[model samples]
Target: MMNFSLPMIFSFFMVLCGLWSFVKYHKHLLNSLLSLEFMMLGVFWLMGLQLTSVGMEIYFSLFFLTLAACEGALGLSLLIYVVRSHGNDYFSSFNLLSC
Candidate 1:
């Protein structure tokens, strides 16, 4: 039990670090998107560990991975669109009220 708990604790800290990075460097679109991906990966790792320890089917992890991939693709597309439209990925140039 001690061994299992140690890894679980480590994974939790991994997720927290991802969250911290996301909050710390959220001014740029690309940085925030990368941080989000990092968080997703950490969560995926945690889910896999928990599921395996519980002896549950691992299919859910695959599904979660698929969603993460889709999310990453979408974020990249958005980043591209923003860069093309605004000439950069900085949030200050977004101009949310401009329509």
Candidate 2:
């Protein structure tokens, strides 16, 4: 069994909080996006700690960070488009068929 360290514990807590926030505020796109960003941060921190603990290279974490950046850019662009079209940022207002 792998031993948990302080960074790992902190990361886990952050991820749990983020997930809870996401579930509790799913109807609010901004809130959900913020929660998702927190979750991604937790993942990055945990992965970095794991890599350092095992004496492995950090390339994978770097790649994941890049991918996360791209995802954020795309997500925000989509959100902007939705807000512009509907004049509101609620997830319930989105309808693919209507677009």
Candidate 3:
């Protein structure tokens, strides 16, 4: 009998989504951001599922969520600038904007 724990499943989602974010990150900006958010959410979910101490998890999740929101905001702003300046959303094109 192969029984999968909830935390284990969530952890797999975290790793898989994290890998996906890194693999395609240099190709498309929007897709990469979405995948990164997915990975972050997976981390939040796993923390909720696997924590032994409710108090610790609550504080950790609060801090993590705050950081995630800041990251998402910065990513979205860069995405907007990339799209407006390049007239496209590819990561390579955005890199050209810096030079």
lDDT (CA) per prediction: 0.90, 0.91, 0.77
TM-score of each model, in listed order: 0.91, 0.93, 0.75
Winning candidate number (TM-score):
2
Off by over 4 Å in 1: 1-4
Give the range of the ten consecutive residues with the poorest summed lDDT in model 1: 1-10
Model 2 is weakest, by summed lDDT over 10 consecutive residues, at: 73-82
Question: How far does residue 1 in candidate 3 sit from its true spot (Å)?
Answer: 18
Residue by residue across 1-99, what tens digits does model 1's lDDT show? 346587778788888988998999989999999888888988999899999998999999999999999999999999999898899998988888875
Count of backbone clashes, every candidate in sequence: 0, 0, 0
lDDT for model 3: 0.77
CA displacement after TM-score superposition, residue 82 of candidate 2 (Å): 0.5
Off by over 4 Å in 2: none
- Superposed by TM-score, candidate 2 places the C-alpha of residue 55 at a distance from the truth, in angstroms, of 0.5
Better of 2 and 3 by TM-score: 2
